[model samples]
Target: MYLVMRKCDDGFRWLETDLGLDNLDLFVADGVLVGHLAWWSAPQRANVSTGDGAISCETSEIFPSRGICREKTKRGVAPSSPDCAMANLPHGGVLKDLYLRDAHKKDALAEEALRLPAVVLTERQLCDLELILNGGFSPLEGFLNQKDYESVVQSIHLSNGLIWSIPINLDVSSEQIVALGIKTGARIALRDPRDDIPLSILTVEDVYRPNKAKEAELVFGANDPAHPAVSYLHNQTKEFYVGGNVEAIRSPSHYDYVSNRYTPTELRSHFKKLDWTRVVAFQTRNPMHRAHRELTVRAARARKAHLLIHPVVGMTKPGDIDHYTRVRVYQALMPKYPNGMAELSLLPLAMRMGGPREAIWHALIRKNHGVTHFIIGRDHAGPGKNSQGKDFYGPYEAQELVEKYKDEIGVEIVPFQMVTYCPDSDEYMPIDEVPKGTTTLDISGTELRRRLRLGLPIPAWFSYPEVVAVLRQAYPPRLQQGFTVFITGLHASGKNSVAHALQVSLNQQGTRPVSLLLGETIRSELSSELGFSKRERDINVQRIAFVAGELTKAGAAVVASMVAPYEEAREQARSTVEKFGGFYLVHVATPLEECEKHDREGIYKRARAGKISGFTGIDDPYEVPKRPNLVVDWSKQSVSQIVHEVVLMLEQDGYLGSS
Candidate 1:
C-alpha cells in the first residue's frame, strides 16, 4: 500500500512506497530518500493519469508545504502560510503565524455555544495561551500531550525531531478532572480566570499523571527548591496533565498596554512597512537603563540591523518588579534611544529561567518573528543560585550553547558588551576597551534596591532620570506600604492572644489599617463547611490568604492566626501574600505539652477522650517551621513580651516606621 503526498506551488512532489521519518509516518524529511518522485502540479485530473502514477487532491491548486511536519491525516487543518512570513529566511521555513489571517479570527465560539464545563486559566496558563495564538510558539497548534511532552522533556526534541526544550502543557488538578467529569474524548472550553470569558476549545487527547521528579531533573537540570522553576513545578502546578490542540475562538482580552502587546504577525507587518529586513531583538525582565540602551544601540549599529526592544511582561522571577511599573519605565526610557533606531513591544512569556537551554529557546522564538539577530548576555535566563550558594550555570554557558547551534537556530547571537561609564571620557565604553589605569564606577542590583528603599539619589550616568522616577513611585519606602504578619501554631497555643494583642497595638499606633483574620471567625464564616482534613485545612488557609492579600494591597497591616500545620500550605500562603506586600511568618513554637496545659477551652481534654477526630497535636502531625521570623513560647515569657518581640520584627523590616 503506497501513500501519496504531493505539493505543487514550487514544483515539490515526492512520494515513496510508504511513509517514513515524520510523525505522519507518510512523509520523510531526513534528507536521505530512495523514493520515486513526480511533479504533480498539473491543472486538471486528466492531465496526470493513473499510468503516470499521480493522485489528485480536492483543491484545484495545492500550495507549497508550509507547516509542522505532522501526521498527515485525512481530516486536519489544511497547510497554509501567512503573508507576514513570506519574507522568511531561506533555511528557517518557520511556519506562518496563526493569528495573521482572517480565517482563524472566526474560530472563536459565541458565549451561548460554550459548554458547561470550563477550565479557568491561571496567570501562567494565560501567558501560554497568548503565545500559542500569537504564533510566538510557531508550529505548535496547542498544548503538548503525553507523546509530545515526554519527547520534548527527555530529548529536547519533538517526535518529529523539532528542537523544543521545554514542556508547555495545560495542567489541572485530579479533583478538577473528576469535578468536570472529563472523559478521554471530550471538548472543554478554556476560560479566562480574570473574567470567565470562553477563549478556546481543547479536544482531549490524553490524561495521565506525570513523574514530577523526573520532569524537574530533566527539564530544569535540578530538583532543588533553590531553582525557581523547580519550586514552581512542585508548588504551583497541579497533578494531572491535559493535552490537545486548541481552536482559537478569540484572543485574550487585555485592558492594559493594548498597543504595546504585539503578536508576531503584527510585528512582522510593522517591520515590513518600515522596510526593516534585518532586525535584532533584545529580551529583558528588568527595566532598561542607560547602559542597556547603549549596548543595544551599539549591537544594532554593528550588525546594520534595526532594533526591537522586546521585554517580557508575563510572570518572571518571583519578586520581579511588577509589569505595570516596568512598562512605565520602558515607556519613559524609549526617548533615550536614537530616534528611529528602536521599536518597543511586549512578550507575554512565563520565563523558566533555564539558562543555556532557555537562551537557545529564546533565539528560536525570535527567529519566528522575522528577527535575524538576538542579544545573549552572561548567564542569560539564569535563576540566581542553587542551595549550595553557587551559580547554576557558567557565565558564558548561554552564549556558548547558542553559538553551538547558530546555523540551525537561524538567529545570530550577539554577546553582550559590558559597558562601563568613564568619568574622564564622559562616555560609556566596553570593559575590555577601557584603558587599564582608568577608574570605573558601578552599582550592584542589591545596592540599587537599598537606594530605592531609602529614597537615595540614583546617578544619572547609571540610568535615565525618567526611569528612576517611575521605579521610585512603584517601590515607595517600605514604611508607607502594606504588609502581612502570618502567625501559625497548634490550637489554643496563644496564637489568637498574640494576634489580638498585636492588632490592638498596631491600631493604637494607627499609621495603617490593621486587619485581623482569626481562625474561629473564618471557620464560622468563610469555611463553615470545611472539615479538619488536610485538603480542607489547606483550602481554609488559602481563603484566609486571599482576604489578607486584598487587605494588604490597600495599605493595611494584616495579622492572621491559624492552625496552619503543613509546611507546604504555609509556603503557599507566603507566596500569595508577598505579591502585594511584606509577608512575615511567625511560628508560635510553644511546646505541645505547654500548649495543651494552657488550653482554657478544654479542647485538649476532648481530644484525649477521643471526642475530637483528627486532633492536630493528638493524631495528626504538625510540621515545624525550620526558620520563622519569631518563635514565641508564652510559657517562658508574657503575652506582652511576645507582642513586643513581634512589633520589633515589624519595625526592623521597614514596615512600621522609617528604617
Candidate 2:
C-alpha cells in the first residue's frame, strides 16, 4: 500500500491510529518499532493544524511527492512559458497532500475517529508507500500487481510502458497473511512496525509469490546476497506480495531536520515564487565535497539554471553515510555556493541502487518536481560490491543509459565530468579539461572511509574542512568510547564461562563499566516467564540486545552470552547493539558431542530420552554463523586461551590498549 503523506509549505501530517495513544507515540513497521515524536509532547508544532493541535511525527520511514499542478510545464525547461501544459504535465501523476490536509480540516477529528484494524509495515514498505503518496514514484498509484510486477522485472518498464526499473511490491509472509486472515478483498490498515500506529489503509487486490530468480537476474543482474538489494530480497523481504490502492491517512512522521524537508509541490511553489525558471537538480546520498561543488556549479552555469541541492533522506545503501551527518555537511557547504545560485532540499526517495535504471527513475522524479535538468554522475546509484569484489555496473553505465532515454525522460541529463583539484594550479577542473601533465589531487570514497576510520587528515584539496569536520564527528576513531562483545553458541558451550572471564578481564583493564548478560542469569532475571517457542526465544534475545545496546550507547563495555540459535535473531541482536558501538560476534563452535559431554546436569540425557520436547541440540536447529569474528572450540581450548584471543581481537580493533 502506497499512501499520501509529506512535509509541505504549510503543516505537519499525522494520522492518529489509536484512541488509547496520547499526543506523543511511536511507529511500528515490519515488527520493528522505530522513532518517537517529541514535537507532539512539546506544545509548539511545525505547521497547519486540526482543532486539537498540529501533529508532529517522529518516523523512521518518511514518505512522498506533492503539488506541482498549479505551475506551467514545458519540455526541457521550467514551467514558465505561456503555452506550457495545462496542468503541471499531469503525466507525472502525484496526489497532493494539500487536498488531504484540506479534507481533514473540514472534518478535523475524522482521522482519529475512524478506527481501523491495523497491519504492521516493514521499513522498506514504509519507504515505498511514502514515495508513492508523494508522487516521487509518479504514474504509480499503488504497489505493483502481478502484471506490472512481471512487466517491470522482465523489461525494466512498467505495464504502461514507462521505463521503470524497480519493482515496488508489498511483501508479507504466508504466516502473517494467515494470522491476519487476510483475503483478496480485505481492507487492512498499514501501521509502522516500529510502534504500530496506522499510516495508511489498503484495499487488497492481488496476493502472489513472485518469480525470485527472474527478478534477481533481470533487475539486479545478480542473485547473491552480497548485493545489498538482493540480500534484502532474500533476508528481509517476505513471501507474499499484497497489491492495492492506498488511502494514506498521514505522512510518515519524522522528528529531524523539519525545516529542510519539503514536498515536491512545496519545492515547485518555492521555485515559482523565486522565479527560478531554469532549475537543475543535483541528487546525492553522500556529502558534497569541493569536487562535487565544482561539478554541480559548472553544470548549473552551463544551463543557466538555478541549483537545487536535492539529497535523499530516505533509505540509501546500507553502510553509506547517515543522512543526519550528510545534511549537516550540506548545510555547512551552502554558503560556499554563489549566493542565490542554489537551494537545498531533502528527497524521501528509497533508492533501489539499480544503477542505470535508477538514473532514469531519478531523472523522471526530478522532472516531476518541475526541474529542467538533472546531473547524472558515474555509476549513479550503483550498489557497491558484488560477491566477486567488483562494481555491479560499469563506471559510465548510468550516464549511457540516461543519455539513451534523455529525451523521453524529459529532464536534460547533465553528465558529471570527473572534477579534481590540481596541486600546481590550486583550482578545480574537469579531469579531461586539465592541461597536459597537470598534477591533480583526489580521494576516492573508499580511501576517505579508510582514512576517517584511522583518524587521518582529509586534506583541503579533497574536501572542505567544514564537510570533513561533519564526517569526522559522525565517524570518530575506532579507539574511542564504546563496544559490545556478543558471544553466541550452543546451550552448554561454555559461552557463559567466556562471558564471565571476558568481563573480569575487561574489569582488570580498569577502563569502562563492563556489563555481562550471561544466559542463565538473563533467563532468570529478564525472561523468567518466556518459554522456548520461536517467538519467545527471539523476544528473549532482543531483550538482551536492548539492555546491552543501551549500556553500549552509554559508553559501557557489554558482554552478552546467549544461545541465540537463529541466524535472524543473532543478526537482529548485532544490528541493535552496533548502532551504539562496535559489535564483535564470537561463535563458540564447540561440537555438539562436547556440549553434551559437559552438560553435567543430565539435560542432554533427558532430551535424548524424549523426556523434553523441542530441545535445541536435539530437535531445534542451531544455525552456525557463516562468518563470526572469532570461533573458539571449548572441547580443545581452555577458557583462559579463548579469553586471551578475545582480548587480542579487542587490542587489534583498538578497543583495548596494546599496553
Candidate 3:
C-alpha cells in the first residue's frame, strides 16, 4: 500500500493506495503523486500515525510548494478533473473579448481618448495589451492590479484563485507617473507607440512600485542577469507598475500576416467551423524544421487531434531571429503539412522566458484559443543560460511543472522528446524509440548557424530547400554580413589608434564598408552636452553603440573605440551591437601607469593634478572585462600587430575570411 497526499483548504489529508513501489518513484518524480511516507511521517498540529508503512495526516499540514499530489483511482491513475474535461471552456468560464466593436462606442471612446493623458505602449506592453483585449489572456480583464500581481508572484495564482502563472502588468517609469499625474481612479488613454493611435482607455486601479527583486526571484526563479527575462526585469522594465481595467477602442494594427493573425475568439470559431473539437497547439518562437515537423505530426496523430502552429511574434530572447524572418519560414512550412490536418496562427506574446512558469502560462493561453493539448518541449520558453553558463532550469522541469498543473490549465500536456533521423530507415523517430546501435544523424542549432555563416551547404535531410532559402536570405554569408569591433581602454590607452588601424585594415579588404566612431569624435559631434559622470558616460557609450548597431545592420563594418570604463556599459554596448550582427569586444589592457606615462593629451596629468574631477583611472574606476574576445597591451604591441590579431580573431569566429 502507498500513501496518497492531497492539499486541502485547511491543510492536507492522506489516503491509502495499493500501488506498487516500482510505479511510485516515477509517479512521484512526474509530480502526479506523492509517496515515500518517511518524508511526511512527522506529526504537525495533530498526531501523525504510521502503520503498514503508511503515514497519515490528522490535522493540518502545509503542502510542499514543488507540487500538490492528486487523488488517484483504484488503478492508481489520476483521473482528469471535470473542468479539464470541459475543454471547450475558456479560463474563468468566459471569453472576455474586450474590444469595442460598435461604431458609436468606438467613436466616443476615441474622442474621449484625445482628452485624457496618453501613455504610449512599448512594443512589449502593446503585445500584452493585444492578448488581454482579445481574450488570449482570458480571465484577465486588464493589467493585473497590485493584489493580483503579488498573488501571482507568491503563489502562481490570482487573488481570485485562478491559476494564472505570470503577471500581466503595465510598468511605467516614475517620470511618467509625475508627468501624467497618474494615480488611483485616473483614466488614461493607451496609445500605440508606432502611430499614436488610441487603442484603449484604462481606468487606473492601483499605481504602486513593485518589489522587482522579489518578482524576478519568484516569477522568473532567479534575479540573475544571465536569464534574459531577469535581465530585462531589472534593466529594461520601468520602476512603477500601473494596473487597471482597460476598455479597448480597437485592436493593435498588424499589417503583416493579416490572415494569420487570429484572436482567441476568431481562432476558436475557425476551429469550430472546421469541425476541429480536439486541437493540439504547437508553440514556437524559432523556425520549424524537419524534426519539428515530425514531432508535431507524431504528437497530433498520437492524440488524434488537429494541429495549430502558433508562434510568438513579439519580444522573445534578445538576439533571437527577427519575427519577420521566422514568420516567413513558418509560412513556407504550411505547404509541407497535410492540408486539412493543420493550420497556422500568430500570437503577439511578449515572452518572459520564465521556463516552468511560462510553460503553464503558454498552456493556458492555448487553452483560451480552444486547444485541447499543448506540445511542451524540453526547457520550454527557457532563457538559454545563466552567467555561469549553466541552464537555469532542468531540461524536463517545464514538462514536469506543466504536468502537475495540466488539470487546472484545462489543456493536456504533450511532452516533447528529441527526435533523431535514422539513416538506415530514412526516417525520423524519437531518440528512445530508435534501436540501440542504430546509426542516427542530426544537425544542432549551433552547427546549422555555423553552416549558414560560412556559406556551406545545409544538408537536405536537415531542412527543406525553401526554408533554407528564406534563412539564407536573412542570414547571408559572413562575407556579405556586417560586424562591429568595439575597442575599450583607459583614457590614453591607444584604443582610438587601434580602432583606426583596424578600420584601415578592414577597408583594404574591400569586402565591406567601414566606419570609424572614435571616442573624441563622438564626444565632439554626438555627445558634446554630456558630462563625465558615470551616468553620462553610460549614455555616451549607448549613443555610440546605437550608431554602430545601425551601421552594422546596414551591412557595414563599424569600429567604435571609446574609453568606456565601466563593465556594465561595455556589456550594454555588446548587447546592442550583437542584435544586428557580429560584435567583437577588444580590450586594450595597456596598464594605467603606461597610459599615464604616455599621456598624449595631458588628460591624465590634469586628472592627477585634480584639474579634472571624476576622471577614469584616477577618482573613478575602470572595471576590466572578465572575458573579452581579444586583449592587447598596446604599450608593448604595435597597432598593426593588434589590428592583425583582431582581424584573425574575427576570421576565426567566421565573421570574416582570410584576405
Q: List RMSD in Å for every model shown.
A: 8.2, 11.4, 13.2
lDDT of 2 by residue, 455-573 (tens): 88889888889988888888866665579989999878999899999999999987788988887788899899999999999999999999989998787889999898899998988
Better of 2 and 3 by TM-score: 3
Over 1-659, each residue of candidate 1 has an lDDT whose tens digit, in order, gives 23234444443333443332222221212111111112323333312112134432222232223222222223121122112122333222333333332132343444432655889999999898878766687657678899889998898777666677778889999888999866678788888888888777777888878889999898877898999998988989999999887766678888899989777766776877777878989999998888899899999999998899989988899889889999999999889888888999988899999998899888877766668899999899999999999998899988997888786676888999899999888788999999999988878899999888777889998998899999988987777678899999998788899999999999987788899999889999989999999999999999999999999888899999998999988998988998888898988888889988878889888998999988899988999986687888877878899999988988887777644
The TM-score, computed over Cα atoms with residue i paired to residue i, of candidate 3 is 0.82
lDDT of 3 at 164: 93
Whole-model Cα lDDT of every candidate shown, in order: 0.77, 0.74, 0.81
Off by over 4 Å in 3: 1-87, 100-104, 386-390, 589-621
How does each model score on TM-score?
A: 0.82, 0.78, 0.82
Ranking by lDDT: 3, 1, 2
The lowest-lDDT stretch of 10 consecutive residues in candidate 1 is: 28-37
Give the per-residue Cα lDDT of candidate 1 at 339: 85
Q: Which candidate is the best by lDDT?
A: 3
Return the TM-score for candidate 1, rounded to 2 decimals: 0.82
lDDT of 3 at 551: 96
Residue-level lDDT of model 3, residues 1-659, one tens digit each, is 33334333444434344443222321111111212222334344422233332333223332322222222221122232111122366665555666522223676788999999999998899999999888788777789999999999999998867799999999999899989989999999999999999999999999999998999899988889998888888888899999998887999988998999988867876876687879889999999899999999999999999899999998898778999999999988888889898999999999999999999999999988888999999999999888788889999999999888777888889999789999889999999999999999999889999899888999878888999999999999887888999998998888988988898898998888999999889999999999988999999999999999999998999998988989898888888988888988999999999998888689888878999899889999999997699989998999999999998888887767652
